[model samples]
Target: MSVVAVVLTALMFVLLGPVAAHAGAGPRDTGSQPVDSYANAIRQSVWVDTGLDGDRDGKTDRVAADIIRPSEPAAAGRQVPVIMDASPYYSCCGRGNESQVKTYDQSGNPVGFPLYYDNYFVPRGYAVVLVDLAGTDRSDGCVDVGGASDITSAKAVIDWLNGRATAYTTRTGSTTAQAGWSNGSVGMIGKSWDGTVANGVAATGVEGLKTIVDISGISSWYDYYFAQGAALYDGGPDELASEVESSGAQSHCSAEEQALRDGAPRNGDWTSAWQDRDYYANASKVKASVFVAQGMQDLNVRTKNFGQWWNALAANGVQRKIWLSQTGHVDPFDYRRSDWVDTLHQWFDHYLMGVDNGVQSQPMADIERTPDHWSTDPVWPAPGTAATQVGLKASGTNGLGSLSAGAPPASGTERYTDNPAQDEDDWAAQADQATASKVSFTTGTLASDLRLSGGGTVTLTATPTTTSAHLSAVLVDLGPATIRNYEDGAEGITTLNTRSCWGDSTSGDSACYLDTAADTENVQQTVFSRGWADLGHYDPSLHGVSLTPGKPYTITIQLASTDHVVPAGHRLALIVAGTDNGLIVAPSTKPTISVDLSRSSADLPLVGGLPALAHALRGGSGHHHPTATTPAATPSRGPAAALPTSQAARLR
Candidate 1:
């Protein structure tokens, strides 16, 4: 159901109380105002303009907002807890009569109301302020996403609130109970853009700001727009732009209005303004207790945002918490309304009101993955984690085996040609179809249960027939019952910044070294650019080619961190190919890939008996029991294999 419907249902319960058998008691207000009456329900919407002289001009930037409050006060004579919901990608679904409450952005693509904000907190006695930020909707000035001015706009909302409650009550009298009762305590909450603003303003250390709940927020724009060591995927951003820009225009707003909201990078305003607004500048300066929520599947913001701030909070010893869900972008899990609503209230109560809601005592982190139910670890990755590499020995078509310590052909190789044309839309062969690639290999059925709650790396030795070749790899959880493929950095521009439980960057050197220690907390990602060298004029000996047709060379591909569990019957398969759906631009114009199987293998560090140390540090959960005997080396052995005679034949 929509957030509106849910709010209404919750409102009914709050207003009528005991709807049925308690008919003798009749309907009561339950200490709240009547739902139908606008005054009683605090349903009247009004736009208040905050006078801020941003440009140092004689005139001020009139920052306007829609104030939605409860009809009656939760606590008389005390300011009710106030939450500021940053308006959506556009200005709509707010209380302003001048602006229609609709989903269309200024351009005309349909945008959802920040219903998660509008309805989620009102019933809980928190007055919500939804601002039509500068240059979007009814507000003035050009929009600058992730810029300093954008942050100023957010702080202006707070400044407006700190002074508006008294003015509102004096003008409207006690009937404006929400304004009258508000203790003036305030907090910031939102997802995505709003979340960004929350983090931004928190850095200012403004008074009345007690807590911030940032969900799906990006801490650094550079890390988001251009992942470290990777290119940007044109598809996702383009689609979002088309939707927002078109919808804003369809809403009948001025073309300039819509442009401000949807055309940031294109207009060059945001780029120019955000150059100095990086999160690393002041992320550690935020004094407010913070709670962050992130999605494991979030392709846009990813884990770096949380990783950055969370680590900062830890290093500074500030109170902080994080929760990861399987959803994408926004809350995708369809969390229960009560759980969602109460979480906000509890957070605010604990911080803003000092109500000891036990939010801190609850799980510091709740991470859930397939085959493994939700597990709460005080530390992320649960510490003392190990990565085991399962080697692959190729045979004909399907006969692939494990890696043995001693093999006769300790340096044999395999070659394949990747067709770049395969990359395409969602489910398109190029995007994620692992079975459609040239350099293909499989893994044997699992001998035991395997659960990888962290990141993994793939290293191999390759000799390109051309000057360079684009390589891609994927890890698949293949059980007898099901098979699911996980992607590596081989496809398109991928985010190289990954966070460990400690909120530190686990990214490696040069984007491929798989370094487990780095200040990911607000550091920019490093991207490697692919360049072409004429193959006819290129000298392999000069290019540091350790791998010959009969020799070996090593190439490493990095996969972002993840928390997942593989069941007992499942096989962890890695597939390598030349083209990665156009996401990975080859080092040269024409690409060919040949892998030396023997000398080429993933370097997965195994922490032998680290489980004991883990127990000592984190205490026993009874689930992390380690074996006494040394784990055997599972080698990749298959039917005898042969090397290709020539590069052309292998390419064919």
Candidate 2:
């Protein structure tokens, strides 16, 4: 631990005392009244300081709290609102960089930050209480991620302020004993990790939590750390955990950090470990209203994760609202403060103060950047959208060609070699893995406006020249100047199988290749939603005129995610490669992939509604079953050959 952590931890114990008061369901009621209803109205004058009690050997301690007495108006029966801002880090040790003011104004602050708990809200009818979390800056106990320790800290502060029979509360309230009673509605607010803590507390069935505001905070580690068949480290090794902890001038305690440590990079293991801290598992027990704020450019907390949390809450019939803004990981308090403060006040007013502010009847999306400003829709992507699947059929003299309704099986096969030994160090860079072996297809002028707004998957009816081969399908949106990489919503992307694997060197088939790891029984698909930072905003009209007789440009769409608006003039391009980029490891260094077009095609489910249409236009759902191709008649069963150990792996 650093020097700051040491001091803050000590101070935390001196102030808050021993929070772990092992209470049983007995006669004594440790439950507290609403802080707003009791603490502020009664306390005549008060002093506050950091609360820290170390060596959880069951010892009580305290530090003075920042106290305030009622002004002249409080001499009457009028009750004032009291607010407490719990510190995620220890107070004296950690420097509060995130909650402080910025040097410059133009450089926006973080997203959905809650900063008015003490300075602004308290003096004006609100009394505030702020405590440092345990084992960080000024608090005690071994830190736990969504653990009992976090709930204990919250309960300790609430109980202490409301005069619940706590050892410290009695001693601290001696000076302010002449004050009247106030309500106990202390609305908790925080962003990112702090918001994550608030969410965890609510899920713990804590009483009087009132309302919660989550900004770019994912409900689960699975979605945040690993998303849609892509290993995060596959992009590059950045100390993600360190980065999160170092923010706000406070590093999480050693125990908390260990609780969130990532293990080996296998999907099965990663998903399993994530299941332990599954935030959604206990969401039904949460009794407070929630307000979620999402940043459009939040690379860590992907938009899909935010959507998942919002959708999950809605699915479980929980009361919640989501706000999407064009910001990054910074506290919204620093950047979009107006929107942040307004929304926070509205939410607190409705839930905490019982004010009918009409916050519930507002639009779901107060979308930034667009001219409309507020595209009010019941759900994401406003309704009435449709998806048009642009087929990638073999055309022209070579295997590469233009789009056709269907194409006959070609006699020859396409071969390529994938040497896993030759790994591209730059994970973010497009390696052009299929440069040696790929068949390209281009579409003619699109008949109507084509917009790709969803993640996609690919299913290739392929046979391996070697025992197994890696297959990658990509959709590219070609522009006039440079290729507009519009496949899935992700920008500046290339190649399919960016983070998955295929191929089997042991199975020898020189003419055809099979992806041993691919789910042949079920179409293999990689769904991409959110996390497309490299993709450029594709607008067909901006790229210049449409198909003018002889000049038609092609936009490449690989097996990736990109959002683009393809105009009538531009062409849609699809590329099939024997190499799957970095997504998956190939089975063979030298292998061939033969495509059976008669058996494979992109089956995009077209439906009305923007969200649905976006899903369809992106296509590549890998659920390709060629309705036009007839299935071969089954022959009589014969004696089975001895199963090879690798056969099960191949059948995967």
Candidate 3:
């Protein structure tokens, strides 16, 4: 090799380094690369004009966009790809671990961005733009709360980058600002609400957007607030809209806020406004490759968002990758740390910079099997996994039914009354209690490890004693182990005192953040999957039907997607009840439910199907006295006959 080849070869090793097994597509690389002293980068702000006037101010709504770019790429020099994060929380609750808000100088130039995106990517020749969603921060409009204004505001920025929209140097100034430094390749990324906006923007099928990284994002607002016609909150988007509104924009946004309340009523019916906020409806229009990271046990955004979005992306044949963590609502930066930054670096380089770094060829799913232990698979739901139905039989030595494989239970009935006071935590802890409020079915100890790979549904064939019924299903692992305590902690990870830096630092901002570790705990059992449904909404539609009090309805509760393992010697329990208190709103009338044991079953996504489940249920029924880990059978709280009984032979 010549001397020039030697210098270039050495630089490749330095820039690419040894990432988490990510390799570039040979040495014939192109485009701008990372440089030193990247701390001294260009910083500025602009206002993008969205076509919608959500606040009815007689002018187009404008979004606030702050930008930072490397210095080497002069304003009129070689163009570079852009990395953007459009968020509504920049001024309300802030972003990241320390809640770092955007800092600006007197000239309105951005001095700092919330997270490490700008610091790490700017030096790597990518311009990082932080956009404030319309109606929040310095943006002009009412908060739309995942509606047209919320999505179109972010879409306008991508339009500007692609030369389809206009941007002004000042909010009120007529002077225009051009993205001359942009090559029209843009990648969107963020966590939580910010990530959701990225999903919304990509759904628009806009030009210039190359890829998006959505971490713990909601693909649909209806899914976020309602599940199968069951309200997850007492109030809906109106509360959230108020929380993220601009300080002085409440009066301007009052009508919009009232519209949220009207569109999303407490009765759990979907509205046209919700369809406008649902990105999954337009998933077929997405032109950009997608990278999704979600928490399997994410109660806030919930796993169904990713499950639905993933299905849509697959149906559309869109390029995609995923990271399913064993934590709760958290950013990959907080959980995976170094590997997240490394993989993200390669992802942007591949999609945005047009570098074939072999990212697309790698395993599509990176799932955390255990706490802090990750495994990669070519596809999610493990390729060979299949849906298997397990019957609930009332034949166990314990009072609960036995989950057996074969034909559905032929001739048994189990009844449970509605109890809105006891939640999943209370139910899981009292599994042996013979309370009429809840019923449970348990599988024998697994002789071998049985893995559940994807999403499934707990379908019940039953009759309700009242006109309306709200039901909940819980899948629990009856074994002691340490697990991420995402049930209590909202973020699912705790920040430590120690700090780690990722890129070059400036006077106003540093690339460093407090290190985080999984918030874990030793538990007797872990509730891995849960689903809720309203019996009145048996068709799984937004509207509820008025059913006769004693009519049997086929209700399918779609389980939240998960990747969990039932270890050999551990038992699996399925708890059936009504109204997950504190989690979702209860029905107006708490009615007792009667389920046909032989007809009801949980359709599970088992990695090995019947053979794997059979092997796990081996070893002579695996029933005996409670082990050191299993909770001993407790006393019953109330007699089973205490529930209301009707002439239809159903318990109420």
Model 1, position 160, has a per-residue lDDT of 51
Tens digit of lDDT per residue, candidate 3, span 1-652?
Answer: 9999999999886545522122235553432345624567888899999988888889998888998887765632667789999987787777886878888788777887989988788877788899888888899998777888888888899889888899999998899999888889999998878888899989999988999999988899888888898887555777777777788677688889889888888777767878888999899999999999998877777788998898899899999999999877678889999999988988898888767667788899998877899999998768879998887877433336667765553677888889887678667666655566777787877788888987888888879988889999989888888887676543458879999998878889899999988888788877888898878888855688876888788888999888888888788888999988766779989898988876788888899898888878877354322421334434322211222122101100
Model 2 bad stretches (over 4 Å): 1-114, 155-182, 228-273, 369-374, 384-652
Better of 1 and 3 by TM-score: 3
Score every model by TM-score.
0.58, 0.53, 0.90
* Top-TM-score structure, candidate number: 3
lDDT of 2: 0.41
Residue-level lDDT tens digits of model 2 in 548-604: 222212222223222344454444555555433333333423455555554445532
Cα displacement (angstroms), candidate 1, residue 80, comes to 1.9
**Candidate 1, residues 146-204: lDDT per residue as tens digits?**
55446766776676556642122221233322344456577887766668778888877
Q: What is the full ranking by TM-score, best candidate first?
A: 3, 1, 2
Q: lDDT score, residue 646, model 2?
A: 26
What is candidate 2's CA lDDT for residue 540?
21
Residue 168 local lDDT, model 1: 27
What TM-score number comes out for model 3?
0.90
lDDT of candidate 1 at residue 217, scale 0 to 100:
78
Residue 282 CA displacement from its true place in model 1, Å: 4.0
